[model samples]
Target: MMYHHLSDAMLDDYLRDVPVPVGLVARLKQTAVPNDAELDELLRSPPMPDGLVDRLQAAIQDEILDESLRQTKVPEKLLVRLRTIPRARRRSAWRRFAVAASLLVVLFSAYCGSLSALLAAMRPKQNRDTTLTIIELYVDPTHSSLLTMSEADPTTIRFAPPTSAEMAELPIELARLDLTPALGPAGHLLQEVRRGAPLTEDVFLMRRNTLGSPQTNDQALPELSHVRRRQIAGVDLPLAPGYDRAFFLKSGIHPPVFPAAGQPTEAIQVPLVTRTDSVDLTRRLLLEGRTPSPSDIRVEDYIAAVRYGLQASNDQSLVLYATAGPSIFGRQPHHMLHLGVKAPRVQTATSTHMSIVVDVSASMRGDDRIGAVHRAFEIVLRHLGPNDSLSFVAVNHEIVRQVDFLPASGAAQLASMIRDLDPSGGDNLAKGFQAAMSLAFEAEVAAGSARHVVLITDGQAAIGDRDAARMRDLVATGETFSIRSTFLQLDRLISAETVPSSTGLEHASAVSPRQLPWRLVTLATGQSPVVARQARLQVAFNPQAVLAYRLFGRGPTAVTGLADVGVETDLHSGEEASALFELWLRPNGTEDVGWAEVHWTDPATGSPLTTERMSIGRSDIAVSDDETLWPLRAVAIVSEVGQRLSGIGDFELLNGRRFSQRKKPAGWKDVLEQAVGVHPSAGEQSDFQQMVDLIRQLEELALRGPK
Candidate 1:
């Protein structure tokens, strides 16, 4: 075992009372001061380095000399005696002093070792890195409504602004936010304070920008919990509580209302915020009496068109809803009609015979018109059961039989022939119907089966008996042969005048029930009265500001106009038909809107059924207060607005004026704002919001003027 030796300078430092290095002091403190046995063993083990003893002696001497020089109180007698001593005697005294200093230094070194032990025993120990950080969030609902503060982590805090969508679902009127454990040198939470208010466009933008900021820590965001209702400032408020350090609070605000002088005063009830759906939004907007865009208008039209049809029952009778109101411009009255026709039940037969006539004309080449015919054939083929016989005829300038009557087994062959056929030449709708009718008649006589003829055309008759009456007569002739006929128009040109006559054959030409095949008789007898001729609806308006109107929800069916005020459509059993009319009203006029009438022939009695005259007076105009009429009104306004926005110039007087107008109508924004106030269902709220957003965008675009 070897003992470590201390440096001479360190020994001098100990004797002079200079601060010892911490490392040496710790080592000395770790072991007791060297024992005498250890010291003697160390001295005997090795000789000290040359001049080491002298160096130690010199250091001690310097320290002693410095201490003596600082003594100001030297006795005068002792100073005189020291000066009288010889120089040689003084030298000897110095040598003796150096030796004494060396001895004292060695003794002080041992005392230093002992002092280090004492110092270590007195020192306290502690962990320097262990620290606790406290994070807190404080909220006061009474002051801050709709404000939320969250402590995401020890170093991050986030402030969330109230969202419109959220407000729409809350009953609060005001909200404020307050954060506690205020930010300090550690970090900050919110850069700015936000107050609660209606989520306006500007507020929406600010909230969006804030949420997108880089400092926002989405993952650490506190989950907000629903809070119990509380009363603040004498008002009830909704508060949503969140994570340990997050809070959301809101209060309600009631609108002021003034009643007429004669009316009794009543407490006002604020409407609770609720979710909204698409239908609800449209309905609310319309009830508020706002001018709707063309798209909005179309939505109502579509709804009306489909809604009535859904109400149809097995009874073949038609259902109708018609109303009128004051136009936005206040001049002419707006007229509307909702019509539904019940469809005929499907007929089944043991054996079937059919004729499909397709027009392969030049115009049919476009819009995949001919392709539509092919698709129809494919559908027909799939429905045909075993023993069903079918024939295909392609007609343009002339009629050509592509496939003669063949059983369902030949369906693949018929389909092939249809696909191979090409379009050319002028349209001859009359000839096509004639050829199809002739084939259907032959099939009826040969098979004594259920015979039907389906004539597909663009309704552009260019040659060969183009007269509408002649075509109707040909269809009647097929009916006499016990063949039912259906005309499918591929283009918009086909009108009620051109569609085949729906009127059944005269009693004189009718085969007696006794002579008719049992199956045919069974379908016609004891069933709901069949629609003989297609039903016709006549619509007229007052003040004559009507420019044009478009119908929606016909669903692959066609409507032929009898005149501006009337139109005709076919109705089949078990099928629902609906029509939505989009009306263009004239500006700056006033009068009672006109009436509507529906005409149809009862196939069972061969008698006509006409609807009672339904009329609308100026007083009948819809107002926002009527909840029942809101949906209707909304649809109508949306339809009109949509048409206008589309730049449709069909309106006679306003066509040119619309494009050249320098200023938008007054109260436009107010109208939209009022519409926004109406509450809707949740499902439709998003759609309604989108419409509102669109309106705002359009307004902005208009402000920028034409590109």
Candidate 2:
């Protein structure tokens, strides 16, 4: 019998099959890779082909082939063949068919045997392939006296590092990584090395719940069971540029911080990297403290941007790479985070006052910005109390329309004007805000109430008699007149006021709560006292090798140990904020493992906010097989697959590629349903289902990827 066979790898890559994550299944020309193992076997099996088979799916075609067909006169032909064949020959023919099936099985597995089964055999009989890492991080209270408050004031991470002797003594199994001090304000981020097949992998943050508490046989944060294939806007980043001392700056900034003890603190220049235009990168980062620019770059572009783009443009000077590698966020908080106002902070029906300036510019015709704006308006309208008055303006060159939702005198006229606000010649947002200020002033005059001017724009501008100073003057005067001018900034604008029409971070806005909705976020969350305003972390141990740590929180800036920051400043408004900090610890040796102290202090207040200490005990915490499915592993895999297949980078990363996350899947809605155990809102059940789908997708990807 003739048999056809193929390897799992060949079938996976060439057959248009990719390993995809579980839940997200939208194949928008940009998503791929994830199918089950047993299911994969069916996919790999060769089938008899026919005209009907060519048109239908493999499974359906199989069913059609298996079904009896034609006039049922099969016995006559079978009887003739049976008579021709000797009884012994007939039995022999059956053995030949069995042998052929065995041959096909061997051929299929010649190269693509099961990875799990092979690894299972190599492992010690008593040992499970999976393992978990648990670390007790703490500091020696007496160590404080050893360093002295003055001596310990960190100018750099190099002043001291964790030692090795104590590390070797820990009771838990651990994978150690190199530790280094961070420069300037950001504190040390702890990184750890995890062994993997494709490359030497590592983790930056760790679990807070597992550290320094009771140990129920504490486990290491899960490792990635397998590598993921991600496509981020189809951009590929080269390793050398980021790790091999390269700097690419499409844009950057220079800040001045003085030195201590008569020492001159040299100016440090930081570069911004991007595949999109430098201006877009700069503007987005400066305003939102995020890489809001679409990631349309190749890994190579990332390398080049890090290497040559960062140098002084004219000189092609290579900037210095910091001790640690690239930040989780490439460029620091220097971009616009606000995509736009996502509705007013409150939709309560309380008596309130608000104003909105819409971007009805001809340019806004088909962008998502308009839809987003409509969404914001809807959310804000929900919070307007009976006593509150909300106003609206559709701006194009000038105030195209205005709606007074309160006074009841001009509501209908305003609505008609709004409906008729067709996209027009240009955007004059400054003028729109001025008019809004005038209206607010008039409203305040008419009735005593809190006055606020909410300016909405793409942050773009078309001049008609205005400048920054002029705009600032209006804002200042309006504020002095007791009217608060809150900017619902949408996009960044470039004009003669900008440098050579260059779009870079050089001229970013220096405002708190950089974007619009954030203002509401701060206001709303501030009402809750439990919302953390400041935190302090104190860590200690081997004071030799470097240690770097980062806190995953929302805000414009990261609080580093070097910065003498007080934790008095409040975080944006929210009932609670949660983050999982991954730490890569590089213990000099097992001997160096011991207790590390972490004290979290606020930036606004020097006093300690949280004084948490964890003591680590070392055992045999080796990286395990279970990590192959950690949620983030799935995310990274999905990212690679998406990027490789389609260039969907911009909003996908921010939205997490629609993969339902466990910790904070979407927002409060998710938190209430999961952690708080509240019933899901109507669509939330679907969200959880989506997460399950993603998990299945991940398993598929793992099974399908090349060994």
Q: How accurate locally is residue 142 in candidate 2, as Cα lDDT from 0 to 100?
A: 33
Tens-digit lDDT string for candidate 1 (431-479): 7767777777666333456777765655554444335567668777777
Q: What is the per-residue lDDT of model 2 for residues 474-567, given as tens digits with 9 covering 90 to 100? A: 7788778767665544432222132311111222232211233444332222222222233222223232221222222111112221222232
Q: Which stretches of candidate 1 lie over 4 Å from their true place?
A: 1-311, 321-351, 361-363, 366-447, 451-642, 645-707
All candidates: TM-score: 0.25, 0.28
Best candidate per TM-score, number?
2
Alpha-carbon deviation at 86 in model 1, angstroms: 99
* Residue 174 CA displacement from its true place in model 2, Å: 87
